[model samples]
Target chain A: MPIYEKHDYPLVDVRRYLEPGPVVLLSSAHNGETDIMTMGWHMMMEFTPALVGCIISPANHSHELVRASGECVINVPTLELANQMVDIGNSTGTRIDKFKEFGLTPQKGTVVSAPMIGECFASFECKLANGKMIDEMGFFVWKVIKAHVDKTVTAPKTLHYRGGGEFMVAGDSLDLSARFKPEML
Target chain B: MPIYEKHDYPLVDVRRYLEPGPVVLLSSAHNGETDIMTMGWHMMMEFTPALVGCIISPANHSHELVRASGECVINVPTLELANQMVDIGNSTGTRIDKFKEFGLTPQKGTVVSAPMIGECFASFECKLANGKMIDEMGFFVWKVIKAHVDKTVTAPKTLHYRGGGEFMVAGDSLDLSARFKPEML
Candidate 1:
C-alpha cells in the first residue's frame, strides 16, 4: 500500500509551506530616494532574456518606488545574511533607510537606478518588462539587463526562506546534466 | 574581513543557480486532449487569493492548451517521481500521451478542467488569471482555486530542480514563526 494519504487540506496557511525560495534583497529607487526590502516571493519566468516576475504588494514602500522608476535590482544573498534578511523583511522601509540600518553598502547598477547590495554574492539589474498588471495582480515582470556574481565561492551557500522565519540553505550539488537536453542546460 | 567577494559575471547562465524551486508537473487540457509538462519556474504571487505565476514557452505544447483552456493544475510531486518528471520534461507531448507512456494516474479536479496527477503529493487546480502578456513574455498568471495535499507524509520529500538535470530535495523544517507577525505568516 502507498504511504501517502492524499486529501484536501486547509488552504489558509498552506502557502507558508508552498512558497519555497531563497530570500533576496530587492532595492529600488525613484525621485532621489532609495530603499531595500527583503523579498522571497519571486520566480524566474524565462530563460533567454532572463525575465523575472515578483509580487510587491502596494502596501510595501518599494512598490511605489519600483513602479515610478520602472526598475529594481535583485540581490541574491548567501546563508550568512539570513538573519539580516529576516530583520530587513520584517521591518518597514517607510521611515528609515534600510541600507544604513542594516550596514549594507549600496553600489550603482549598470542599467537601472536601483543600487545593488555590496554584501550580496550576486545582483541582477532589471528593467520592468510589464507593469500593467501591478494594480490588479501586484505582479511586476522584469527583464534582467546586467548580472554579477562572486565567482570565488563556486560552492556558495544560498538561503531559501521557509515561512515563519525559518530558512533552508542550498545543500548539495547533484549532477543530472547527462539526463537533460543541451538546450535546457 | 567578511570573506565575501563580488564581481560581474555573465548574465546568460546565472539563472541556472539563482532560480530555485521544487520540480512540479503542470497539467493542461484543451479540446479533450490532455498534456503534462514538467516545470520548475513558478512562484507564489499572492496569499489570500493564492495566485501563482509560471512560464510556458510558446514552444511548449501546453502553452496553447493552457491559453485556450484558461486553466491548468500545478501538481507537486515527491522525490520518488524525480526521474519521471525529468523524462517527461525532456520529451515533447506532440505525438505521445505522457500519462499513458509514463504510467501516471490522472484524477479530475474540482474547479478546473485540468486533471490532477494521482501520484503527486499535492495538487493545485488553477485558473488562468491573466494572459495579456503571454504573447510578449510567455508568462501566465493563475489563481489557485483548490489545493490538495497528502497528509500521511507530513514531512514530504520534495524535489527542487537544480540546473542541468540536477535536483534538490527539501531538508529539515525550521520554525521561526514566533518571530514573524501573524498577518505575514
Candidate 2:
C-alpha cells in the first residue's frame, strides 16, 4: 500500500475530486470504536460551505458510528485499492477491523476524530450539517471543514462503481476551459 | 449527432448509468415552455422505488419549470454531446431557445411531458417523489418511472465534470463479479 504524502487542500475546491462521482471510503469513530465502509451514493450540494449529501443506510455498522459521532472522513481511493474496496463493501465492519484487515494505515484527522486512509489520494473531514433526512432516508448533509490531498497525484485513476462488482476507471481528462464562459468557469 | 434507437430499460437498474457519477443533462417542461440544463450534482438514493436525489438551484431556469410541473427527464449524455452540454449550461433559456439554437432533436416522453434529448444515450423520466428539501437546499428527490436506453452502446463514453471546465471521460471496465457475494449483488 502506498502511503500518500498529503497537504492541506482548499475546502471550496474539494468538489474537484468528489463531484466526478467516484466511490469513496467513509471512516468513522464512536465510543473508541472505529469503522470503515465503501460508499457510492453521494453528491455535492454546495461549494462555498462545501456541503455534501449522501445516503448511509442503517444496515451498515459504519452508519451507527457516523450517526453517533456526527463526523466522518470521506476518503477518495484510486484503482490501486480496488481489491480492498470490494472486500470492504462485501464484509461488515462488525466482523473485522477494516484498517487492520486490509492492511491500510489509519491517519488521525485534523478536524475530526474519524481516521483517514493513508493510501487514498484525498480525504475530506466532515461534520454533519443537517440530519433532518436521516430518519426518513438515511441521508446525511455534511459540511466539509478540512481537506487533505496528495498534490503530486494529478488525474488519479479513481474507481466508479456500476453495481454487480463492475468498476469504471477514470480516463483521460478533456480540458474545455477555452469553451466555458469566464463566469461559468 | 447520432439519434440512438432506444428501448425500455428497467427502472430498478437505472443506477448502472447514474451511480458512476457522470454529468447529466436535465430537461424540464412547464406549461408551453421547455428547458434543458447541464447538471453534475446528482446521486441515486434508492433501488426499488428508483429514487434519485439532485440539486437544482433556484437560480437555474429549470428549477421553476420542474417545481411547477413536478416532473423532469434526466438524460445521460455521452462525450459526443459535451459541447452542447457546456453551451446549455453557459446560456440561459430565458435568453434563447436551447433546442432550436443547438439544433438538437427533442423526443416526447412516455411518462412525462418533459422532452428527452434525442442525441443522448439514455433518458429517465421522473416524477417528484419528495420536495421537502427544495426550499431549504434546492434538493429534489425523484422517482424514475420510465427509462429508455440504447442497448447497442455498451460502455458509453460518459463525461464526469471536475471544476474549471475539466472532464474525466469514462474508461475501461473491470468486472469483478466473481469476487462479489451473490446476495450483495
Candidate 3:
C-alpha cells in the first residue's frame, strides 16, 4: 500500500477527481459513531460553491449517520484499495467498526466530524447543502467545504463501478486543451 | 468510425453503461429543431424506474428544447467520438444544427421525439420525471423509458472528462464478482 501524503486542495477544483465518476468511499460520523459506505451514484453539481449530488439509499447504515450529522467526507479510492472498497460495501457498520476491521487509518477532518480515510489519495469534506429530496428520492446535495488531495499522483488509477462487481480502472489521459476554446477551458 | 448495430436493451440495466461516469452526448428535439450537447454532469439515480439525474445549465441550447419537449436521448460515445464530443461542448447549438454540423447520424427514437445519435454505441431514451430543481439548480431528473445498445462492443473505451479539456479513457476491467455476496450481485 502506498502512503498518501495529502495536502489542502482547492474546494472548487475537486471535480477533477470526482467528475470522472470514480466510486467513492463516503465516511460519516455522528454521536461518536462512524461508518464508511461505497458510493458510485454521485455527480458534481456546481463549481463555485463546490456542490455535489448523490443517492444514499436509506437501507445503508451510513444514511442515518449522515442525515443526523448533516456531514460526510467523500474519499476517492484508487485501484490499490479495490478489495477494501468492496469489503466496506459488503459489510455493515452496525455490526463492526469499518476503520478498524478494514485496517484503514481514519484521520480527523478540518471542518467536519467525519474522518477521512488516510489510505485514499483524495478526500473532500462536505456538508449537506440540500436534503429536500432525501425522503422522496434518497438524494443529498452536498457542499464541499474543504478538499485534500495528494499532488504527487497526477493520474490516479480510480475505480469506476460497472455493476456485477466489475470496475473500469482509470487509463491514459488525452490533453485536448489546445482543441478547447479559451473560455471553455 | 465503427458501425454500431444497436438493439433493444433492458431499461433496468442501463446503469451498467452509465454508472461509470462516462461523458455522454445528449440529443434533444422540439418544434422540429434538434440539438446535441456534450454532458458530463450526470448520474444514475435509480434502477427500477431507470432514473438518471443530470445538470443541464439553462444557458445550453438543449435545456430549452428538453424543457419544452420533456424528452431527450442519452447517447454513450466511445473514443472514436472524442473529437466530436469536445467540439460539441466547445460550440453551442444555438447558432447551427449540431447534427448536420458534426456529421452525426440522427435516428428517431421509439418513445420520444428526440433523435439518438446513430454513431454512438448506446442510447437511452428519457422522459423528464422531475423538473422541480431546474429553476434553482439546473437539475433534471429523467426516467429512461427505452434503451438501445450495441452488443458487440463488450468493454467500451468511454471518455471520462477531467477539468481543463483532459479526459481519462476507459481502461482494463477487473471482475470481482466472486468477492460479492449473491444478493449484492
Candidate 4:
C-alpha cells in the first residue's frame, strides 16, 4: 500500500464520503490470476458469525474470481494509495496481474486461500455465503473468517469516493456539543 | 425527514452517524419507547440463509432490547442524513427520544418488532437465529427475515465509517473494464 500524509479538506465534500462510506478495495486470485477493484456498496449485516454484504455488478472480473474461489480480501486503502485505487478500479485483472501492475504485495490468509494486502492497515479474508446472491438484483454476501490491521500504523486515514469526481479523507474526531442535548428539553 | 437540496451542508458529522459494515445496532423499547444504536463490530458469516454477525456493546440500550424483543431492524442510512447520523450516533436513546429529537419517523416492520426507519432508503427486519451470538466474547448473529430498499428510488448512495470523525460516501457505477483477457502464459 502506498503511504501519504494526513489531510484536512473542507467538511462539505467530506459528508458525502462519510454518509455513503468508503469505496472498499477488494482483491482475489482464482485459477492463478489475481484482480483488484473498488467497491463501496458493502455493509456488515451481522456480528456473531461475521457476515458482510458487498454488491457486485455481475460484470467485474473480481465477481468471477470471487464466485470461482469463494473468497476475497477486503482491504482498506488510505488516500496515499488514491491513484493506485483509481487504476485498480478501472483496470480488469483478466489481462494483467493487478498486484504487480499496481505494486501491491500479497500475503497468505489465516482462514481462506484468498490473500490479504501486506500494506493495507486493515484487511479481511472472507468466503462466500452460498446461494445468497439476490437473483441478480442485490449485493453478494460473504462470511469473514479473519481480519487484521497493521499494529504500528497508529491512525488509518483512508480514502472514500463520493458520487462523481468527489473523494474525502477520513478526518479527526470532533465531540458533539456537550450541551446540545441538555438544551433540547 | 429534513429534505434538502442536492448539495446542502447540514452541519452534521458523518462519523457521528450510523455506520455500515455491521458491528451491532441494538433494538430496545423502554416504557413503550424504542430506539437503535451502532454496533461497531460485526461479521457477514454465511450467504445461504442470508445470515449476518453483530456484536452488541454492553452499554447500548438496544442490546437489552434485542434480547427482550428478539428482533431488530437494520436501518441503512445514507449520506443525505450524515448530520443527523452523528446526532443519533453520539447520543443514547436510553435518555433521549432519538426519533422525536431528530424529527424522524419510524414504520412497522414486516417480520420483526424492531421498527424500521421510515425515511431511509433501505431497511431489513430480521428474526433471531438459534445458537447465534458468540459467547460474551464475540457478537450475535441474526437470521434476516426481510430486506427492503425503496424501489422507487434508483442509484442511491450508501455510507461508510472508518471510525473516529471520518466517513465515505458510496458513488455511482464504474462499468466493468472492457479490457480484454489474455491467454494463459
The best candidate in terms of DockQ = 3
lDDT of 3 by residue, B1-185 (tens): 66588999998889999999999999999999998999999999999999999999989999999999999999999999999999999997475989899889989889999999999999999999999899999999999999999988889999999998999999999999899878888
Per-residue lDDT of model 2, residues A1-185, tens digit only: 78999999999999999999999999999988889999999999999899999999999998899999999999999998999998898997474778999999999999899999999989999999999999999999999999999999989899998888899999999999899999999
Runs in model 2 with CA error above 4 Å?
A93-95, B93-95
For each candidate in turn, the TM-score is 0.83, 0.99, 0.99, 0.53
Give the poorly placed runs of model 4, Cα more than 4 Å off.
A1-20, A175-185, B1-185
Model 4 residue B60 distance off true place after TM-score fit, in angstroms: 12
Q: Against the hidden true structure, what lDDT does model 4 obtain?
A: 0.56
Instruction: Give the per-residue Cα lDDT of candidate 1 at B97.
Output: 80
Listed per model, the TM-scores of chain A against the true chain A are 0.85, 0.98, 0.98, 0.79
Off by over 4 Å in 1: A1-20, B1-20
Worst 10 residues of 2 chain A by lDDT: A89-98
- DockQ, per model, reads 0.24, 0.91, 0.92, 0.09
Writing each residue's lDDT as its tens digit, candidate 2 over B9-122 gives 998889999999999999999988999999999999999999999999999999999999999999999999989989998986484668898888899999899999999989
Give a tens-digit lDDT track for model 1, residues A36-62. Answer: 887777877765656778889888899
Query: Which parts of model 3 are misplaced by more than 4 Å?
Result: none
Candidate 4: interface RMSD in Å? Answer: 10.0
lDDT of 4 by residue, A10-118 (tens): 2222222222345578888788777787765566545445666666666677878888888888877766676677766667546687778788877777677767776
Check candidate 3 and list the clashing pairs.
none
